[model samples]
Structures are given as structure tokens and as C-alpha cells.
Target: MSTATAGFPLLTVTAALPAVGAVATAAVPAARRTAAKWLALLVSLGTLALAATVLLRFQPGGDRYQLTESHAWIADFGVRYELGVDGIGAALIGLTALLVPFVIGAAWHDADPAEGDAPTGRRWRPTQGFFALILAVEAMVVISFAATDVFLFYIFFEAMLIPMYFLIGGFGDRAHSAGEEEGAKQRSYAAVKFLLYNLAGGLIMLAAVVGLYVVTADQLGEGTFSLQAITEARASGELDMATGTERLLFLGFFFAFAVKAPLWPLHTWLPNAMGEATAPVAVLITAVVDKVGTFAMLRFCLGLFPGASGWATPVVIGLALVSILYGALLAVGQRDIKRLIAYASISHFGFIVLGIFAMTSQGQGGATLYMVFHGISTAALMLVAGFLISRRGSRLIADYGGVQKAAPVLAGTFLVGGLATLSLPGLAPFISEFLVLVGTFSRYPVAGIVATAGIILAALYVLLLYQRTMTGPLEKEEIKRLPDLRARELAVVAPLIAFLIFLGVFPKPLTDVVNPAVEHTLSDVRKTDPKPEHPVADKGWFDYTPGGDHE
Candidate 1:
């Protein structure tokens, strides 16, 4: 599931070029905002091209991690500037590159006052700055995805908050607050919640990362803090820990990812953030940013603590099921479309968690694919919802009616996205959801059956939202004059629609790349534990349905 092609520093160029654009955009003058936006767009496009090249050149069935690069960054602290992509990371990095430019394009017209309008004050400057911040965030997120060294990953992981903080607090929806001034305050509150929760979780993870380093160093005598090295040392039985210490380390990592995954109970911050943040910012958060949690869980938790992960599967599955039912019920009662989507995301994340903890190859592979699919689906849903908000100046579902009669393209696109969210057949969500369900059924049939009802609830909520907003008579004066998606708006949404269908009907290409990594990971977990017998075939990958057969 890795590529071993030379002559292409594809990963670095794709991850860092957008950062360069962010810096360059900051240097541009207010009068030349168009130039800054174009520069950012071009940089994003270049990165996308690089990602595509990586995809094209990748050897899908070869190594487990490919296009790998490593160097010493902070040797005194045992941190290396190491980066690589297994199938999961590569797919996510590609998703980031694809989505960021669309996010920029989504807000490009809004970044400054539209043509023929003169900005009156600091508004234009801050708006433009938000675009730059988004680009910077995209850069940091891509780096996080590519990072393999624990310390380097943590740095990028936490550093992502700054740009996003400003993006929401400075340039989010003004309608959410009591007034324009209160809008900023609301955003600030959400930002603080996001920062505090993530920071607290991160500090815990930092202790665990350090704890891991110490354990490796103490046990192996000359260990470095490379993910590969730590993993190898653990596999070889060089580093050992008591059960209690392993559990503590697991919680440290678990709390951080759970918060980001916004797993139930720990998910209070997400609704507030979605309620106040701009659509573009919300897209980044839901689609790209939140993936960091699951990504890290897959990379560190499952990779580093396989036995602990396996042992703790039931508790995790229980939480995931709770999130599934709870999030859906909450979504049904929500008046705000954005908040509704936020809750829906929590539900979907529960499914991902379920898949991961299923401890089956199909479940793991489906979880990985679901991350990418959800990113696209959620972005599409949020952006279209944003378009509705911008035109009508409200996010309340009651505020919209007969939008289909008024805006056919918006209605149609929203329906497509909504159907995808509900995991309608022939769409991208269906395939991944089926895989997760099928995978989980192999281990926890009862939980899987209960969780399947979430799909039905999702259908109901999405349909109800769509019918209330788009299909009814244009009830309000504001809804009467709403416009269909403009050319600029189409630019923002078209790619997401394309990808939703692309991944739906033709996911095999991606699954081929990912299966090898999933296989490798499962093999390592079973190797380290060697109990409860896993399905390890001579093909070197485990099949999900079979029980107690490690060949």
C-alpha cells in the first residue's frame, strides 16, 4: 500500500508548498487581494497535482509505507523530521489537498467584497486574512498527515489550532451572534473551547509520547523516537510495560483522539464551533481537521498498543454505539442545519470508531475509506448549506422553504449530498457504511444491528431537513428571492460531487492500496499478542469473517 518511486519528493512538495503560499499571501497588500487569492489557489492546485502524481506513481501492492523521507530535526529531544504515507495517510493527504482549494474557492468571492462593492473598513483585511489562515491550516494538516515521527506529528497536530482559531473567531458567520460584535465574541468562545479541549487532550498525549520514548529508551538502551523504530522495538519484545502503565498510556492517547473525533460525551465543543464558525472553516474542521483524531488513533493507538486496543475494543464499541444513537436523536430535534450536520458528524464518527474497534480487516479498511468519504460528503453538505445561509442569512431549517422551486441547482446538489450523508445506495457513503457494518458484524453482530438503525435515522433526518428547506412553498420573504448556485459557487462544490460518485462506484483502486497496510497492521497486532487467534492467511493479510485461524 506504499509507493517506492524515486525522483519525486512528492510528499514534501505537496505538504509544504501551501505553507509557502500562506506566507506569500500575507505579504500581499490589501489593494491586491485578488492576486493573493489567485496565488493561494494556484499553490493549492500545485499541491493537488503533486498528490495526483503520487497517486499515479504509487505501487499499490508493494511496501506498507512509501515515498518515505526522514531526517533529524531535534536530536537532543529524539525528535526527527520524519514523514511517510501508508495507504491511509496517502489517501488522507490527497483528500486534504483536494478539499482545501475548494474551501478557498468557496470563500474567494467572500474574502473581499464582491466586484463592484467597496469595503468600508477593517472587514476586507480580516476577510482576506481568513483565507490565508485557511491555507496555512491546510498546510499544517497535510504535514500532520505525512508525519511519522511522534514528536513531529504532535507539533503539527497542535500547531493547527492557531490559524483555525483566527478563522472562526475573526471571520465566521455574523448572524450567530446578537450583533456583528457579538458574532466575534461567539466565535471567540467556540475557539477557546476548541483550543482548551484540544490543548488539554494534547498535553495528556504529550506525556504519553514522552512516556513511550522513555520506555523505549529504557528497554532498548539506544532507542530513537522514530515511529518505525518504536514499533519494531515493541514487536521484538524489547519494550515491556505493566498492564496499568499500558492502560494509562492508552488513555492519554485515547482522550486526545476522542475529543477530536468528538466522540460522544467529549463532543460538547463541536456543536458550538459549527454553530459559530463560517462554512468554509466548518468544512476544514469536519472534513480535514477532525480526521486527525482518527488518523492518530489508527497510527499510534492501534499501531503502538495493539494488545491494549484489542483488549479495550468492547468499551470503545459501546461508546461508538452510544454516539450513533445519541447523535441521531439530537440531530432530529435540531433547528439549525449547521448544528444538525455537526451532530450528524458525531454519529458518523461513532461508526468509524466502531469499525476500528471491530478488529477486523474489513472494518479497519472501511474505517480508513470512511474517513476520506466522510470528508468529501461533509464538505459538500456544509458548503451547500452555507450557500443557503449566505443567500437567506439564516441557518434555521424553519427559515427555508420551497428552495427547490427557487434554486433548483442548490436543491438538487443538496439532495445529492444529503442522500450521500444518509448512505444511500450507489453513493460513496453506502460502500463504506456497508463495509463497516459487514466488518463489525463479524465480531459484534448485535452492536452492528443496532448501529444499522442509525442509517435509517440518518435518512429520515436528512430527508426531513431537505424537505423542510427545499421542497416546501417559499414561505418567508427571504426564501423567495434566494439564488441558485452561482458560477463561483459551482466551482466550490463540483469537485466534491465528483469525488462522492467517484469513490462510490470505483473505490476498488483505493481499497487495493489500503488493504496491504490494513493487512500489515493486523499482522503486527496478532504477532505481538498471539492470543484469541486471528485470521492470518499465507497471503499475509487477515480475513475478517473467519475465526481462530492464523496461518
Candidate 2:
């Protein structure tokens, strides 16, 4: 029985609804910008409800990919419109839906017109277009997560950069250290750099995709870009590749994902992009858009080339270690709050990549959870910071002080965000970070020991960011008059903070969903959790067998 056999086109509707909403929102009259905003918000909420339905209907004990929909498209080329969700894909889909509404609310006025802003020039901030582009990006990302066909995944994977590019370049941050003209130039540079980097990666991936087709044609007497088809062929010993060919294919796929993941050397564009873009868009970049990359690593790089995946782990893990330490060290030195957060995200992504390559169930499972929790936590922190930056019209740490005195609620929320970033025990990120480190230690102890340094650096940066910005004497007049978060703003942030606390205490719901997928992925890579030298029971330390005495 095929996992992707005939079913209700639920997954297609889930993704397509937002894409349709984007078009509707974009068509609203310019004077009706407010209406456009409400429509986008409502669409995102609807998308969320649909995503929740997918989650509820998903059976963890069922087939690996469930609620799948497959249709014939480009049949001659063996390309089909196939969409499916395993636990990981479903969880990520939920994360995207969960965050988009908050992003919409926080960005309610982020794209509104400003003084000196040209009504008809490059400097114009089209309110409807901004919201529309966001919906558009969400639609692409949702489909990217749900896509099971290799070619189908790649199409949306590269297509998403279009809306994102416009979002970064067109609707830039109003608060710039430089003059408006200079900021505009900087925004252009960031947008171009972002596009060029990913485009270059996408082209390479395209070549690899072509190469994959050739391999299939020669070995199987047909060409197919179906993931299930290819994986089944490999498992049955009907398809084989030379070591060098498999390694090349793995590198090609991994490179594109790493760039999207924006690992280390390729990561230079993120800070500039995040700094120049509005806060919500920055969240969209790291929290939503970037997950596609790491998720692809799990889906394509490993799923298609398990042998080469093992061959490449050493180097991949090495790069991940560099990203962790390097991003943290740079973040500590950053003066701009948005850029600081950007660098911190790069560090967190490093940990995620490390866990994925750690090739253990705990590491992979933790990486999956990290994706979910980090999105919630970063959104909590970044959206609050955006609100603060908007009020003060500054992104500099030196420009803030005594914020706690006037806006105690705002300061408290900021504190929660900061603590969550540092992976404090009671926050959602701690569990994921702990599992990553444990998984790294189990397979790569020396790397794990070094990765601990990143945690210390995280604490330093988070606390210092808080100490400098949230506390101190009321020196600046703006800081003195800072207003507390309003009801609308509270609506944006409160739920995110609650999620951090709730998930921090109880991560079982997510773990239960994520672990099975991690096991499936481990099978693809032929890896297992390391057994403890001295076990109290038959199970290994990482085992999550339901807790009860067995007779």
C-alpha cells in the first residue's frame, strides 16, 4: 500500500488557501490598507485552523507519510504534484501556521507610509503589498514542508525567494543609523546579497536534480523525482550509485540547504538583511523561511543519499561547531539589537545542524523540537524588540536605558524572551538545546564539549542585552517616556511567551510526534542512539519507552 495513495486534497487546500489570500489581499484598493491587513490576518488564522486539523488527524502510529495527496503532473517526466506530512513535516507546518498570525498582528503598521517616504518611488511602503507578500511567503513555505516529490519540493523551495526578496528590499526598517538614502542603499545591498547567495545555491541544486534524473533513468529504466519511489528503489537493492556519484549528489543537495540554513561563511547576509528589514520580516526570515533549509537536510540530503550522509557528517559537524561559537562571539559584540538577534539565530541554527548530523534519535528529535521552540521563542523576543525599536526609533543598545521604569510589562516580556534565548531551565529552548548537546556528546564528545562554550556565550549576550537595555537610570528622555505595551501589542506577544513557558515544562506532546519521525530518519541514515555503558534497564539512555514497570 502506498502511503501517498488517494485521499482528500487536504494538504493542497492548506497550502493553497494562503496563496489565494495573498492575491485577494494584494487587490485591495490602496486606501483600503487596513482592510487588507485584517483580511491577511483572518486568512492566516484560517490557515492555522486547517493546520491544527492536520495535526489532529495525523496518526503517530500510522504510516510514515499520512494524509497524503498525489496527482499526475508532467507524467512523461515522472513529475507529480505529491504532498505528504510525516510527524516532522506536520509539526513544522503547525509552527508556520502558529506564527503567521502573530507576525501579522505585530506588523500591523510596519508597512504603513511615513513622512518623506515617496508615494510612487522605491521608498514607498505599500501596506497591502507588504501583507500580501507575507501571505505569499507563508503559502510557499507551507507547501515546501508538505511537498514529498523531490521536484515538487525544489520548485517551492526556490520560488519563495521572490516574495522574501521584495519584503526585504521594499519594506525596510524606518529606524536606521544612517540617513534614509543610505539606508535604502543598504537595504538594496542586503536584498541582492540574499538573492544572489540563494540563487547560486539553487542553480547548483538544479544541476544536481538533473543529475538525479539521469541516475534513475540509467539504473531503473525510467526517470522519476518521487521521493518514495527513489527511497524504495534504494532499499530494495534495485538502485545503486558509485561512491563518488553519491557523495557528489549529497554535497549538491546539502550545499543548497546549508546556504538556506545560512550556515557560517554563507551566513554573512542574514544580519544585514535582518537589520535593514522590519522585525516581523526578520522573524519570517529566520523563524519561518529558514526552517525549510534544515528541514530539507533531513528530508533530501539524508533520505536520498544515506551512505554519503554518513561520509559527510564529520565535516558537517565541524562546520556546525564553528557556526555555534562564531555566531555567539560576534553576537556579543554587536551594538544593533536586530543584528545581535540575527547573529544569535545563526548560532542556534548551528546547534540544530549539529544535532541533525549527530545521527542519533535524541539529536534529530531535539533538532526537530528546536525548530518549533526556537521559532516561538525568537518570535516572542524579536516582536517585542520590534515594538521597542519602533517606539524609540532606534536599534542601538546605547540608545536604551531605564525601559523597565516606564514600561514594566514591556521590560518583563523582554526578560522572558532573553531568558528563553539563553535556554534557561524553565523555557522551551532548554529542552531542545539539552537534547542536542547530549546527542552530540553521545556521538561526538569532543565536539559536544566545545559546543558548551556557545551556551556560556549565549548567557552573556542575553543577560548583557537585558542589563544594558532593560535596566539602569532614566538617562534618555525617550526611555523615560516609554509607554507600556498596549492591548494590541499584548495580543501579539503574550501567547508566544505562554508557549515558551508551557512547552518548557511539558514538551512531551511535541516529542511524541517528533520522535517517530526522528526514528524513521535514523533508519534512512542507518544510525542509532549510542548505548550507555552501564544501563539500569534493558533500554538505552535515550530511550523514551512509556514509563511503567514491566513484568
Candidate 3:
């Protein structure tokens, strides 16, 4: 049986609830900003609960794309409002939900106005506008992941920029600036640069989406732009594009995802954005927002244009390797804690890109799981670094030394998070990274070996950062006086640490769900790239099991 059967619209409602909350938050008065925060929190928490419910109800080893809901919004134009998620999408949505509440809570006490004789003319307002902007982001990100329709996905994909633009330019930190004007100007430039790059990429994708529609309709007799319909037509050999058209469409989508992934040479905007945005905001930008790129590459580039994907794999793999080495080398040279995290993200994304292009079940599955693991690990490190920056009033690593003596809890937590970043054994990242390497090696042995070097470099950066910040003697008087984590702060961070341990020691359950979805995706891709001479005809690793689904 096909896994395309429609289920309840649970995922759709979950995606839409945040937008509803955004509207509600906007309705509140300016003087009652606290109420807006509470409302946004409640809304985000509700979305988390709904996501958990979906996780509980999700059936493993079944057909892909469960919890689907579709309604034809424009029959004449072949547009439909469709929503669904397989295990891969569900895993990412779960990560987004988990991060939203934490990001919101972390920003709770960040409001202060520097209208007085403060050293830094910084003003923090946890305003209704800010909370509403965050809610809008959560809404769009969830929708983007949940959207199965190409059109709806693109809409949510582009919609994300508005909130992020405002969050960085309007609500970000400007304390270290030469003056408020300069600070605000820097923030504005980062926001606009981000928007322009992403918008240009989106326009390219828009052309591709239209091209896809035209090709399908021309080939398949008044074709509908439905994902399932398109696939079915292709399966029946009723629809196929010219090689040139296919390659063009593939690039239209590829360029957009690469920019979002901020792969190698296109990664210029990330450092500036990370440096200027507030830490909590930076967490979402790096953790959830940037994932759109990699995920889209998997969903669009591979799913729709498998032949082109095969042709482009080597070029993309080379670029991924470059990002890995380049990002890590740059990270080691960073003085700012936040920019270091940003650079590390670029390196991690390179690893993810490698997994995607590996073109094996294990490689792809490992890549998907890496998305979840890295999101958690990166958020933890960034939040901890944010707290450290908050207390020290500086993000420069030189400003920190011997914090372990004064802030043991912070030191301990930072150590754990940092180790997790480097994929220490018995940690969540280790299992995922190992799977990626093993899988990549099965297909591309040389690239896999080089990728392993990236892992060694990861260890270097992570450990060096920890030793420099948390281990040395408390030389500065301020370092000796640095306060440990308060109970509330620990409350926010402890659960993330617990999850790391839980996911690390016992990853099978998550893997079980993940592997099957990956198997199904690989199976589909093989249908497009059939190998008749292979022992398993038109089958990838998904059909490798003896006397099972393949028969």
C-alpha cells in the first residue's frame, strides 16, 4: 500500500496555531507587553504539546507522509493547500518546537533601557512586538517543514525573512558599538543583506516552480501541480523534462538552499547576522532557520530531479568538503564567542551537506539525524555562551579565563555542551556523525576519509574553546567573581543536557523511526535512477533486506 493516504490535519493545525498566536499577541496594548509575552509562551508551549502528540501517534515502518491534509485552494491554477510530514519532517518540527519555548524563556529577563548613565547605551525591551515576531517565525518554520506542496512550502519559506529581519534590526544587542547610530546602522545592514540574498534566491526558485508546473502540464495532459499527482505521472512515464530544463530547475532550487545553508563562499551573511542578532535570536537563525536550505535540497533537488542530483553530486561534495575545512579553520581564528559558534555552524552544515550528497540510505538518514542532534547541541553551546557574554559584558574569548573557579556550574555545563559539539563518545552527535561517516564511506570512501579529518578538526576547536574559557586559572578578578548559574538559568539548560544524554545512550528508537523513512526516500529515488544490472533491480539500500518489502 502507498504511504500517501490522508490522515487527520494535525500537522496543519500545529503549523497554523502559531500564526493565530501572532495575531492574538498583536491585538494586545503596548503598555501590557508582559501579557503578550505570556500569550506567546502559552502559544509556543501549546505547539510543543501538539508536536509531542504527533510524535506519540506517528506509526513507524508504515508508509511515508502521514498526517496529511489537502484542500484545493485554486483549482483553476492547480494550487492546493497541502500539509504533511514523514518521520524526517516530524523530527525537524519537533526540534523547532523544542527550541521555541527555550528561546522565548531565555529572553524573559533581557529587557533594560539604557536611558540612564550606563556605560553602554543599550536598551532591551521584551516588547509585544518582539514576542509576536518570534511567534511569526515559529509559525512559518513549522509550516515550511510540514508543507508537502511545493507552492505552500515556498510561501512559508520566504515568509520567514520578515520576522528575522525585525528581530535582528529592532530587538538585537547594540551595547559595544561606538555609538547608537553606528550600532543601529550595522544591525540594519545585516538584516537587509540577509533579506536581499534570501530574496534573490527565492526568486530563482519561483521561476523553477513555474517551470515545473508548465513541464508537468505539457507532458501529462492538463497536469495538476500536486506533489503526489506529479510523482504518479512520472512513475507512469507520462511526464519527463528535457535534460537542460531539468538542470536549470535543479539549480534554481539549489542556489536558494545553498544560500540558506550558507554553504562555503555564500556564507558571508551568517557571521554578521550572528554577531549582530541577540543570542536567543541567533539560536533560531542557526539552529532552525538555516535548516531550510539543506532540507530543501533533499526534498526538491534530489526528490524532483534525481538524474541532475546524480550529475551534480561530485561538484556539491567538493564544495561541502571546502566548507568543512574552511569553516573550521576560520572558527579557530575567531576571538568572539558568537562568531566562533557561527563558523562552527558553517562547518557542521558542510557535514550535513556531505551526508545528503552521499546518495546512500545510511548517509541520508545520518544526515537527517545530524540535523536534530546538531540543533540541540548548537543551541546549548550558544545559550551558555550567551549567558557568559551577559555576565562578562563582552563576547571576546580573551575576556574570559579561569571561570571554573567562580562559576563551576556554568563551567561544567559549558564543558558538557562543548564536548557534545565535538561528538564525544556516548553523546548524541557522535552517533549521528559516525553513521554519516560510515554511510559516506560505503559510497565515497575518499570523501569519507577527508570528512573524518573534519571531525578531528572539530575536536580541536571545541576542546580548545573549552580549555581557554572554562579550565584555566581565574587570573582576572572579574573571572574570580563571576557568578555561577542561578536556579532559573539551570532550569532552562538542564533539560537540554538531559536530552543529550538520553539520545546518546539510547538512540535506537529515534533511529528506528528515522531509518524507515530514509529507506522509503531512497527507494523512491532509486525508482528514478534504476540500475537494471545490479542484483537488486531498481532498488537502493532500502530493499537490501532478505525477503522483505522489496519482493
Q: Could you tally the backbone clashes for each prediction?
A: 1, 0, 0
Question: Of the pair 2 and 3, which is ahead by lDDT?
Answer: 2
**Prediction RMSDs, each to the true structure:** 3.8, 3.7, 4.4
Q: Write the per-residue lDDT of candidate 3 for residues 1-551, one digit (tens) a residue.
A: 23544455688778888889988987888778778878988999999998887776678866677778888887877889877777888888998999898888877655434456255644445477788888899989998887878888889899899899989887766444346678778888889888998899899999999999889778876746666667666556677878899899889889999999989888889988988788889998999999888888877687787767877888999999899888888888888888898998999999899988887777888899889999999888888888888788777888888898899999898988888888999889988888888777766778888988888888888888888888777789878778899877787788889989999999887887777777766655662121223455355543222112222
- The regions of model 1 sitting more than 4 angstroms off are 1-8, 113-123, 527-551
lDDT of 3 at 505: 99
Q: Write the per-residue lDDT of candidate 1 for residues 464-494, one digit (tens) a residue.
A: 9998998866777777788789998998888
| Top-lDDT candidate index | 2
In model 1, the clashing pairs are 402-472
Residue-level lDDT for 544 in candidate 2: 28
Supply candidate 2's per-residue lDDT for 256.
93
Model 3, 94: alpha-carbon shift in Å? 0.7
* Top candidate by TM-score: 2
lDDT of 1 at 110: 56
List runs of model 3 lying over 4 Å from the truth.
Answer: 1-8, 111-126, 175-179, 527-551
Worst 10 residues of 2 by lDDT: 542-551
- Order by TM-score, highest first: 2, 1, 3
